[model samples]
Target chain A: MSKKVLVLGETREGALRNVSFEAIAAAKKISGGGEVVAVLLGESVSDFGNELVAYGADRVITVEHPHLKSYTSDGYGQAFMAVVDQEQPEAIVFGHTAVGKDLSPKIASKLQTGLISDVTDIEGEGDDAVFIRPIYSGKAFEKVKLKEDGVVFVTVRPNNIAPLEREERSGDVSSLSVDITNLRTIIKNVVRKSAEGVDLSEAKVIIAGGRGVKSKEGFEPLQELADLLGGAVGASRGACDADYCDYSLQIGQTGKVVTPDLYIAAGISGAIQHMAGMSNSKVIVAINKDPEANIFKVADYGIVGDLFDVIPLLTEEFKKVM
Target chain B: MNIYVLVKRTFDTEEKLVVSGGQIQEDGAEFIINPYDEYAIEEAITVRDAHGGEVTVVTIGDEEAEKQLRTALAMGADKAVLINTEDDVEEMDQFTAAYILAEYLKDKEADLILAGNVAIDGGSGQVGPRVADLLDINYVTTITSLEIEGETVKIVRDIEGDAEELETSLPLLVTAQQGLNEPRYPSLPGIMKAKKKPLEELELDDLDIDEEDVEAKTETIEVYLPPKKEAGRILEGEIPSQVSELVSLLRSEAKVI
Candidate 1:
């Protein structure tokens, strides 16, 4: 059977999330010369039909309803379930965002199939898809194979894969509707925080800190450096526990997993938890006073000094170039 | 209102894990309730204390899981439920576990469901959200802070680099992360009282879920030690020569420059 890859696109406040396009680009690679279907469920599909094709989706399977405007588990799941049942795609891919995180497992359960969630890598392997997931709080890597015969599910972590653009290519756009009267949960409203710049998960450059950052005042330098490079800031679990920063900024086993192009660790001792989150970055740079710190193990570049000094210099140099 | 806090007995993360024959060796290691889940239990118990609700601690594991269950009860949960699943649970994927738990909560009067954002063991982080999906309940994850204000739940989750706050009604599902609340230790009296509290044990059928419903999409193919690290060479010299040597290493050998 020819491969048909289905991507579960995500939306934020009634618009397609960037990760949705990134997922479609990834699914197209796994298509192996088969069709690419982007499954979209929301209140309105009229506005997103054209953008879906620009991101390499051969076909757009849109499921729209008034109740589906906000994110309700039942409404969205039912819509995707109907689409999957109607068209038995070989594999389904999703970007592991909040909506995708909530929707993928339910779809897997309804289908009585298996899913590889939060996958960072995927490759086609002889009639089956091989998925790479972090196990043991990112201490280990597990390569999983979806054993089911048809319609396997895999949710890749956002920003891990680069998005691609395609021109002069398009496919069918179909609509789907399902009964959601029995849904148990409802999203009454979706409130968003108006923040500028890329999400940490999507940033190509990252500047992270740890407990060694002394005090809350120490974070300003890192922020200054991040701003200079148009990057995001991350924290270690210890720093979060110390209240030097919010837990949301913490990057560790219990926190967000990010894979950026350039990752700079400042003052972090590189605990296993912290490593689990950002170890997958393309290039790693560590700045710490402790020469014996474990962060140097995986760091492509290491500076055995104070971040307060090194960061300002680096930021200034980068500013001069940009 | 009844609150359910899910707990899992896992290997102590502080200890170095040894994988023998593709299974985690826990013969000599200590076990405890997942650290993150401790926050969930603490938050649930706090909610119960303030609102006059019953807090039920639930787990799906072997009889050994009872120790953690007892610990939670000792910490002041009103009751405990153990789905004795060790024999049949080779590796119950998140989907199967969520389906089973959702069915178990079907007729129960639960106003809130609390789970750790992710178990350190499986590290899938999909269970809580999947359970909310199966139950069709509003789900919020990575909640760093939570406040209950008379039938409403306000949550603060970390998004990108900022804190994103959400407001939802009762009878919802939430996954707790660190900083949500500090888990409390069991008082001497509370520990003693836990022995008298009821710990209900149920079979798989009690959850109204079949064993075959959940299929494992991913399995541990193998577990082996990571690659060895190269010893660092001590560069002892004047600053200029050391910098020159480092530059040489980067340019010629490492080629990372």
Candidate 2:
């Protein structure tokens, strides 16, 4: 049952994202006493190799090339394939992030293999493992497995897997020089809009708004409460469409799916589409004056009062308690 | 420019899913064009309009998928093709789907291809890049903005919540994420024109693809609904007291805080 699982350690701003380590954790679960070889590709990424090692990787392969500076499917795919050819891993794991979502499929196609994307949980072990992923957004769940075992490609959803605590161990780091070719897409530049803090997908708590939040300025209070609780601000599609917030903060069937520990839906009416994103939150608190709102139906705690009133009070009360 | 947009018919996200007999029951389900693909169809139409070319909408599904294809045509796609795999193949997954679609598109000489970032139903998001890979072309997924100047193209793709602005060329495939564009609803005249837009129906054999060549790589071990959550507890009385109790409960019962 021993299997060699290769994990792609994804990076952002010269550091390994938490999901990369989480993928290593997943690889450990499915590794079944086998080796976990982690690959990091970039123009410069020796730290990524050591970081993956600090978390959990039997060996590290740092695929470095100038074209790997930016994440183009062609560049990353070419570099990873070179590593794949050399290592001959039986399985591959990715974080299911923006880059992972875009790159994994192309790599799978090159390998002429099957890929299970956005897996939330892994059950069983090794070859017989089953992957659980959300279908219809988060409204339903399905268990899938590779039909015929060739090379198992999996992309694990962010925050769904447990991230390893950095143990800071020195692992075997081998630098790989790869030739990245087939130049197609060139990075012009990147625009950074995400607020620096708890990543929305991985946040422990979320304070979400809806169209009921009204103007763009109406999000100020929600942001305040989110900041107070060290959570992240989220928005329903209605809020995003109404120009109250950005689409990146939107959560629905068409947007990001999150499973936060505490979900505070302020003005959201809990549309089926929006519910598809957060119905799985561990504790949902609905603060709306309408007692019959659909959000209350799915909420674990409901306050039949305006969010503007309830949020500030809750923030103040938590301030005292904490 | 010659363009193709890949579309899928999926369960309407608004409707409640009914899973009976260990499979999702489709008898009473309401199906529509996948929402993300609406962005794809809309973007394809926009690209064709700006660049002066024809847009073809393609799908791989049963005869029931024809309705969704027509919907795309009504939205301004010039032609539609339904690759009916119902009689030819079974248990289609992302791999099989990309294979079938890539085969259908291999000879089309498409200058540009567009599809949804992910389907609302399966949510695999592998088909666009997979098809592009099979066609040996460049691809970008979850794209928010696109611009074309002759053979040169500029794209702004969503990377997490951030954006990566890139430059690529024609003969490129890009998946349409939400915020790419507001998809147009089929106008009355557009719908009328769509009825006569030469909807071609082809089987898998028409693409010269054997069933074994497009076999699905993954299998559904099980399908089930999410576990039901307990009913919510409504807090009444004064807002201040309610908030205090909520805080106390979080610390005592929920323990999340």
DockQ per candidate: 0.32, 0.84
What TM-score would chain A of each candidate receive against the reference chain A?
0.89, 0.96
Give Cα distance to truth, residue A42, candidate 2, Å: 1.8
Candidate 2 ranges beyond 4 A from true positions: none
Give the CAPRI class of candidate 2: high
Best by TM-score: 2
Candidate 1 lDDT over A1-322, as tens digits, reads 4578888877664567778888887687677778889988877775686678788888888888876766655677778888888888887888887667767767776666677778776666435456777677656667777655646677888776678855766667888766656544444333343225556777777889998898889898888877776788888988888888766677877777888877889999988778878887766778788989999888877777777877776666556545
For model 2, residues B1-257, the per-residue Cα lDDT tens digits are: 89999999999887888888778888877999999999999999998888798999999899999999988988899999999999888799999999999999999999999999999999999999999999999998999999998778999998878888999998999999889999999999999999999899999888898999998999988889998888989987899999999988877999888
Per-residue CA lDDT of model 2 for A54-79, tens digit only, reads: 89998999988888888888888888
TM-score of each: 0.86, 0.98
Flag regions of model 1 displaced more than 4 Å.
A11-18, A41-51, A63-75, A85-88, A162-168, A172-195, A320-322, B133-138, B145-167, B205-210, B213-220, B223-257
Cα lDDT, all candidates: 0.75, 0.89
- Best DockQ among the predictions, by candidate number: 2
